[model samples]
Target: MELITLLLLACALAMDSFAVSITAGLSLKQFNATTMSRISVTFALFQGLMPVIGWSLGTNFAAAISRYDHWIVFALLCFIGGKMIYDAIQQHEQAHCINIYSKRTICSLAIATSIDALAVGFTFSLLEVDIVFSAFIIGLMTFIFSFAGLTIGLKLGSIFQRKVEFIGGLLLIAIGTKVLITHLLT
Candidate 1:
């Protein structure tokens, strides 16, 4: 793919990470640079890694990955999103329980968001693209977008507070549903 096309693809792939980062920002009580960096970096790493994995798997397994990748993504996102909504509801009376800063949650979110990238990697293999360079661009774009999304979400959250988390959860579910629908339709 041309650089412009690759860049556009990167942006497309990064959308999920961007939205998830926004949700992470919404859950934070205060903005912490370290936390934001951790989240963004984790997302970047996964976003980068998934494509390489897909490339490695190559066309031989593309059909298999495509067959189930959307389902896996849907399950992960729905579970996490549902948990966020449930936590938000419970935290209305009690202290907030979901920690966006937690390593486990971060890893889960990263993996959940990057599943699509794996499929992209498979496409890259078929296209005979330079996987390393493409993955780097994807990671770089995801890092930038994820960081910006979190910052924006933090600003929005300052005005909206806890309700932002609920919205974030809904966004996640919406994203998951969109992924499923797109695959099913195609």
Candidate 2:
């Protein structure tokens, strides 16, 4: 995949972490770099790790699905993107609950946010992309977005959650469509 596409994918995947980080920021009564870094690191770690896991699993089955791999990739991205949009719709009705003091809560949030990346990993495994580089980009983007979200959340609150999610979802769907079209054309 192109660097631009990988960057965009990383950003799209980071949206959940960004939103959660925003919530985490909102929960902060006072600014603490340690707490913010911890949350951001955890989110990034999971975001990066999930893809590796997914890629591993996908590679195992890549030969079986090679014939229709592009279709599968398209479907997986669309499904994840669709889910993000669906979740964004319902997210407004729910309350953000993040406990910075609890390791478990942070880890849980990180895992929840990065599930899409795991699926993305499955796609990456089939593609002619570099998994290590892709994973690094995803992790780095998640960290940057997550940290920024936390900072903004502390100052601005939860106003951007829905919009960010909605945009991220749309971006993923668009990327998926592009991949499918690119494959068909070639």
Worst 10 residues of 1 by lDDT: 89-98
Using lDDT, give the best candidate's number. Answer: 2
Which pairs, if any, clash in model 1?
Answer: none
TM-scores, in order shown?
0.66, 0.97
Q: Candidate 2, after superposition: displacement of residue 171 in Å?
A: 1.1
RMSD of 2: 1.1
**Per-residue error at 71 for model 2, in Å?**
0.9
lDDT of candidate 1 over 1-186, digit per residue (tens):
679767766776676677667666778767788889989999999999999998898757556566676776577557656765664555342222447868998898899878877866765665568999999999999999888878977777433334544564666566567667876898
Model 1: lDDT to the true structure: 0.73
TM-score of 1: 0.66
All-Cα superposition RMSD per candidate: 7.0, 1.1
Which residue runs does candidate 2 get wrong by more than 4 Å? Answer: 92-94
